[model samples]
Target: MDTNKVDNKGYLDMELLRFSTAGSVDDGKSTLIGRLLYDSKAIFQDQIEAIEKASAQKGDEHINLALLTDGLRAEREQGITIDVAYRYFSTPKRKFIIADTPGHIQYTRNMVTGASTSNLSIILVDSRNGIIEQTHRHTFIASLLQIPHVVVCINKMDLVDWSQEVFEKIKAEYSAFVSKLNIKDITFIPISALNGDNVVDRSENMPWYKGSTLLYHLETVHIGSDHNHIDCRFPVQYVIRPQSVEFHDYRGYAGRIAGGIFKKDDKIMALPSGFTSSIKSIDTFEGEIEQAFAPMSVTITLEDDIDISRGDMIVRENNVPKIGQDIELMICWLNETPLKLNGKYALMHTSRECRCIIKDVKYKININTLHRNEEDKNIGLNDIGRISVRTTTPLFYDTYRRNRNTGSLIIIDEQTNETVGAGMII
Candidate 1:
């Protein structure tokens, strides 16, 4: 057995997890976040001391863990999270990025923005309150965004005396509700974010619970397959022509690999043009690479001088994406004004950009119960709805369930120049 080779392979198997926290105000979201960071030893001593001093100045009896994530002046003064605060931390097993979003209903757009690219969503629920309408809304949004995993942290367990009965009751209630959702993986944990119980370390208080700590679960969750690895979709962002004396004939197509893997000498086709080409070499700032995968930005040189440019898609020859001008999408309205019926808008889908118009409002979803109301003509702010759109140019993409990077798009209001809605290809 080759021990050195085994060790080398093991080193490359480590995973990265991106998760976002969503909960109503006072759901102990900030405290749970602070606990995760503190217990993981990701926080610096100086930062802790600074928070402690601030806590004392505020006449707090104990250090307020929520203060660790409440960095904005408005949030501190108002005692509410306004904007999304992103935090990064890592352990020996995995790396993580936390998107802590505000809980207010008006900040639904912010939550969408934060969870759009997340692999998991940590929804905080107050143990005392059990489940509320806000919980349903957040979970629905998580399902709507197609987050792969969800961890329901039943916070403030200490306030409920760490009772096993209480935990089970809440878990059952949440489970029954989430059963209606499309979420595949759902786990519940009884935790006290303030006391750091069952967040990073196992809670001795809750002997009835047998699950791993939240940190352990997060670090161990399988996330490598969360990204699309079957369909090879690369949208050309730019044409790199380094017309220098050293490399006079250099012409490479620069873009990020949106899905699957790309290697040297693989056969690929340019969308809209249907031009066949073979990969000559895949180059990066670090030099040539033998292969590339989702999110890796590289310049690919082809064997043939095909006329490929921006707004074009490079995909596997056999695994071509759906190309069409009529798209059916599930859009989350972000603007206060009602969606202009059949109004023209600009659609941005990966590197392929085009103008689109809402063909018709299919139905509006009731977030609390996930019910579709076709009678409601009002698609106001914070409303999620299904609609059909007609684009000026055809877009080459896969369904959101197949490829998030290529399946999601944003609609801009031409008059206001503001992003009005975000859509997931159905």
Candidate 2:
């Protein structure tokens, strides 16, 4: 099993699970990721040597597995992850993309950025600490982002002598808090990432626990239903015109499928320009696929030569997304500057872009408490708020919970051209 030469076709056929790791500082977020990669033999010899040398320099008796993910120089020195670091690894069963997010309260925005696209989230809880505020904060963010599954990894069991009582207490408390959220699935696993207990291999120490290891659960979790396949949504990112002599008349609309199944000869409507056409062909580099679904990029040619371009969407005639200029949604303020209700910012959704003004500040949520605060209408950095946005053009969109690709948007500050906010439409 040469890892580098992992069967390309087999890997392509295997399911990909995008998961994010989150926890408070010193809670072994990076260590757990490294453990998964190491125990599964995903790292190369050079990587192992580099980790060993780095560990020895740090005067660590054990291999500093955290070094695998904390790649930044400042992060290595400060011993705190300051930014979202992405790591990719694969097993026989599934491919994985891990978003190792920061745990500090100030980096809530970074956590959101990391977890937004994740199908699952692994929140580490130090057994000694039980369930803490950061745990609540991360869970709330996970719920807000509509992450389908959560794994509460009660880490550092070695410090607590592998006590089942400690693990149960933390799990019970966290479950009670999560019941109020929209999270559909939750699993609790007790492990010591540093000691390599119950991360990849089953731990002999945890005979009392019968649950599968973290990697097993990750490989087997039901993610097929994670995508929204009911609503047909495709935002045209580009209009392709072939210049080659073989196909000079070729015209195809290019973009990733935002939602639902798009098949050949299906009746489609181009958005923002209400023209109707049937799909002539769904083209990919590997030839035309008979059908395409969410997350797959393809070029579609229409039977009728209806005018279509970037910022336009192709959707099924029925159950089309609502088109409107006034949109209300929950937004997380990401910039250092406070949100201005009067300010006009550039709003980008899918392949569409428009100038939008924050018409009104609805309310901000207290992340830890999961309660809405209306009196304090000010939305500052890292504050989660509901706001009214009036766009210059009508948007073909769905709620974030329904279609993440079409429902999520970013607000960019026009002056600095910086992304100021992230919004999930209600």
Candidate 3:
């Protein structure tokens, strides 16, 4: 294979999509991923031979595709996934990143970590079991994380004789339940992962289904609108100063664009300081860029020499983020220890770090039932609830639904320095 030829043929320009899979035990989540990789020709021959040998050693009659994803020894012995396994593959049209998360209820925190940054989510449902508690749990998490796209792959269609009735029944049930959810985009497909039906290629057995296959949908889905381009948010991460004799006075603010488009000569405002400046130029390693947008990393030079440093945000004067010390948010406790009320923890936002105290626990949410427990203030591991926080410094943020990068934060235990909770500004 010619590496240079592949690189020059628009390989670096291809758009990347991150997706995650979730389901209950024996629901075929791992098998579906293996089939996707196999049918897409993403796996090598030696990997296939190794899985075949492992399957034979276990005395299985057929090769187990689930072994491709369940890489840990404990997972193989218990026949269940325990951690979040990430796999990468690419087709001619686009590149893909798959996060295979554990399905057990106790590992709910693992699923949250995997799906937090995903553009889409796949919730595998066993056709024999239909909609269950775990299905609701995963769906609710997908919604909480604001994953834009959802594909409910109803697996094991072969076991039900490829019946169209079973497919529609599950679809209808899911639709009725999800009507109350905040999910905007959802697609349902019936597939037998073990048989390679409707995963990558079109299924011959399911003639009644007229929709595109899973891979086709993933490649064609419109994700350009998933980002927040209306709000201008750029949190300064580093201040670059040159000590060279040729360009000794050059100073640039370096950070990833959190939102909106920033163009050369555009007027911008610095947060906390309230100083205004015009963009002198945008600097990138390749060359001076004319403009930059959300999620792009670039260094910007301002016309003024006003004092600026890390943790300060640059934004549009008219459309500024909310600046305050008190914030209300939905908190997901991640550690094994219970969250302490009125406890102080190290809080980190985009390019900013400070200390925050849990001022109040408003309510705890039951993910399975989508109910809020107003009376219970105690929050434990894998538990999600609404809480009010008071930070040491004013935080500039937008609602998580509007801007994920600016609205999300992590709380660390001050003594252990371990991350104990994650929050989304409500």
Candidate with best lDDT: 3
The segments of candidate 1 whose C-alpha lies over 4 angstroms from its true place after superposition are 1-15, 49-62
Per residue, candidate 2 scores C-alpha lDDT tens digits across 69-108 of: 7898998898777788888888877889999888777898
Q: In model 3, what lDDT does residue 213 have?
A: 86
Residue-pair clashes per prediction, in order, are 0, 0, 0
The per-model lDDT (C-alpha) reads 0.87, 0.89, 0.90
Q: How big is the RMSD of model 3? A: 1.9
- Any runs in candidate 3 off by more than 4 Å, and if so which? 1-10
The TM-score of candidate 3 is 0.96
TM-score of 2: 0.94
Which is the winner by TM-score between candidate 1 and candidate 3?
3
lDDT of 1 by residue, 281-334 (tens): 999888899999987889999999999999899998899999999999999998
In candidate 2 the C-alpha lDDT for residue 41 amounts to 74
Give the least accurate 10-residue stretch of model 3, judged by summed lDDT.
Answer: 1-10
Name the top TM-score candidate.
3
TM-score of each: 0.92, 0.94, 0.96
In terms of TM-score, which candidate is stronger, 2 or 3? 3
Whole-model alpha-carbon lDDT for candidate 2:
0.89
Q: Let me know the TM-score candidate 1 reaches against the reference structure.
A: 0.92
